[model samples]
Target: MKLDKYTVGKRYGKALFELAIEKHEADSIYQDLLKLREIFHEVPDLGDILSDVRLEPYEKDEIMKQLVSGFEGTIENFLYVVYNYSRMNDLLLMIDEYERRYDEHKSLLLGTALTAVPLTKEQHQLMEEKAAKLLGYEQANLINLIDPDIVGGVIIEANYKVIDGSIHKQLERIQELLLK
Candidate 1:
């Protein structure tokens, strides 16, 4: 049966994460995957080539060999297993799921902050500290993004939770109260 990328990611990603934890190599494997993901992002067609039906088996194998050249241990095995099972297209999704698991294991939180203007380094550090405390994580990393519509202040989204402190949101709240 054909599987969606998310499903493929969960199954394969969970198995690989469990293995890495068992071998006490989760950190190394995570680093390898980070680099692999970067490369895949850099060369967008790499994944397509692996999963392309038009490519000869030998040609794909050669490419896979080169791709796995520097990646050893669990990650190397993972690449082969993904290709052997024809799951190359789902590789990035699996890596992302693995990253989520790793972050959970490390007590890290990833989030985004929407603001009208870019945050200064000091503001960023302060926000990170606040997010970590509020979210009860050891560390919280936020990607600061500009949204002129926010009008000012910040809207923090972390682990599906939103802390909307933006001026736009406050104004909307006030307007709702007035309408009521």
Candidate 2:
């Protein structure tokens, strides 16, 4: 099928996801996307090079080929599609959205957990289990963040939903109530 811009991105992402799953390389693909995101940010001219209409399609393809030479197979194809469609500007967003969809399809929730201190491995595991149970997901990928400003307690964010259990937030709510 001829895919639209969004569908093209979804297709690219789905293809990569399937390949990664089959090869047990999902983590590698995720890391590759992270690296690509960083490279795109660091090299300001790269985007222009990809999107430059002056360059013939073959020339652009060559440039992309060199850029992704060291990437995993799945990511290599992802870059090829991005370059072929001249969607360099949307590359990172497309990959991120695709990953999000892939995670959702696997019954996994990607989220962040903020705490006053770093969590122990046991605590992390417990939190992951609790989050999965509460969110009704089979798995949870919880990114941990340490924020002393939180004073104590934890805050969790999943799928744009925030569960605030932080002392800082509680204090703010109390202060507001007192003022009222």
Candidate 3:
């Protein structure tokens, strides 16, 4: 029976998650996902090939086997299931969703913080404390990025919300107020 794209992807993710847990290889699977992302980015044609409906299942399976030959055991099985179900096009998304679910299972919240300059160790620790309190989560995986356009201050993004305290935004607001 054929599954829809989302259904296939979700099923693949769930299967991978379970296998990773059973094998105590969640970190390995996550690393494999990152490697696969790089492979997909470097080989644009691979996506086209996977998304092609003209390919036979056996041919597709062969291609997937070659592509994922060196991956960790859990990742190999995950890729097999994805290709068998003709859901290879959703491979990256499914892996990402799986990683997110895994992180949630570990009680870690992912966040992004942007600043005009690199944060000091003290600042980072303070940010973590504040973020933990605000998010009501004991742990966070905070990704920091430098955005000089901000001029100063920082922006914290989590769960689709942006907490902007950037000097660029402040300047724009000031300019707007002055113009009125």
What C-alpha lDDT values do all the predictions have? 0.92, 0.82, 0.79
Weakest ten-residue segment in model 3 by summed lDDT: 78-87
lDDT tens digits by residue: candidate 1, 109-148: 9999898999999999899889889989989999999999
Q: Output the TM-score of candidate 1.
A: 0.93
What residue pairs are clashing in model 2?
none
Q: Can you write out model 3's per-residue Cα lDDT over 1-89, one digit (the tens) per residue? A: 86666776677777788878888988878888888988988886785687678988677667777898878566776677666655678
TM-score-sorted candidate list, best first: 1, 3, 2
Each candidate's number of clashing pairs is 0, 0, 0
lDDT of 2 at 135: 88
lDDT of 3: 0.79
TM per candidate comes to 0.93, 0.67, 0.71
Q: Which stretches of candidate 2 lie above 4 Å from their native place?
A: 1-47, 56-58, 64-81
178: Cα error in model 1, Å: 1.0
- Tens-place lDDT per residue, model 2, 1-180, is 755667666666777777778888877787788788789888867867898999897887787877888784767777877777777766766677657866887789889999999999999988988988898999898999999999988899999988889999999999999999
